[model samples]
Target: MREWLKQLREEKGLTQESVAAGSFINRAYYSQIENGVRNPSYEVAAKIAETFDINPARFFAGKISEPFTLALKNAPIVVAHCDLELKYTWFHHPHGVFTPEEVIGKTDEELGIYKGIPELIGMKKLIIEKGMPMKKFIVFQQHAGEKTYVVFGEPLMDESGEIVGAATVSMDVTEE
Candidate 1:
């Protein structure tokens, strides 16, 4: 399925019917495109993009390279995506004792995993607000032990080039 398309639609607070109406396409056809059951023609893609006010190129930019995916999975790093509200939307390879379920849809402060570390939260906010990339070394002290991570974050932009969120990759640097 086009997960990114779904995310964009949800972010815009649009329904399939609304999008179809706006794009001059059938709702079922739009549903098929969204569910990956059917591929849209370039014309159709352009129409949908126009409806969303995004570039048609976004439709073709959905897939990540398998090699990059493999590299991230094999590396000792945690990757996450957070919306402008600072709530986690996607998390992978969590470190420490936290699980994905505990992190998703929650803020760092809400999870209490990075409590007393306002810098980490502030960094995410800065990236989103300033639309810039940032990197820092953060140390977390838990009951289990102390762990250090080199965290890198960049702003996520939407079709009109507005910052909508932040994406982060944090590699364990304690052993390094």
Candidate 2:
């Protein structure tokens, strides 16, 4: 996969279909790039970058890690990760509800809102320190209304099995 704009798309809360609509490539091809199943050519990556209003080189600078499981194309999810210092490193795809910036470079305590703060804090701590993976359902109350999300968190481990960061995947389960 291209590893370029997946995280960015998640950040901007843009769906594959919407982002690829007017671009040269289609949603399937773009999904291939995002899923790490194929790599985009320089021209393709550049064209895609142009459509997203980001510099082409931005795609080349960093690689987006494929977390536990990628949400289906246009799937409602908000994924995030934090470093050892507990600063938000990756915050993307907020299911069209929560603010993306609320999680970026900020801790749960820092946000000081959202339901199940203690559970989230403990989950993150265990993942970052002990490399535990967890999955559970949680309810969050927002000004819009209350929604339940199936949330998963795990330690982002390195090649040596050392914990580096904490990763989270959240899918809205209110309908379920």
Best candidate, TM-score: 1
Q: What is the lDDT of residue 88 in candidate 1?
A: 76
Per-residue lDDT tens digits of candidate 1, residues 37-87?
Answer: 998888999999888765565465334334555666567788888888887
Model 2 global lDDT (CA atoms, 0 to 1):
0.69
lDDT of 2 by residue, 54-122 (tens): 435434433443342343436777777777777665667724543544455457787775776667777
TM-score of each: 0.58, 0.54
Q: Which stretches of candidate 2 lie over 4 Å from their true place?
A: 1-73, 97-102
| Model 1 backbone overlap count | 0
lDDT, model 2, position 175: 81
What's the TM for model 2? 0.54
Which pairs, if any, clash in model 1? Answer: none
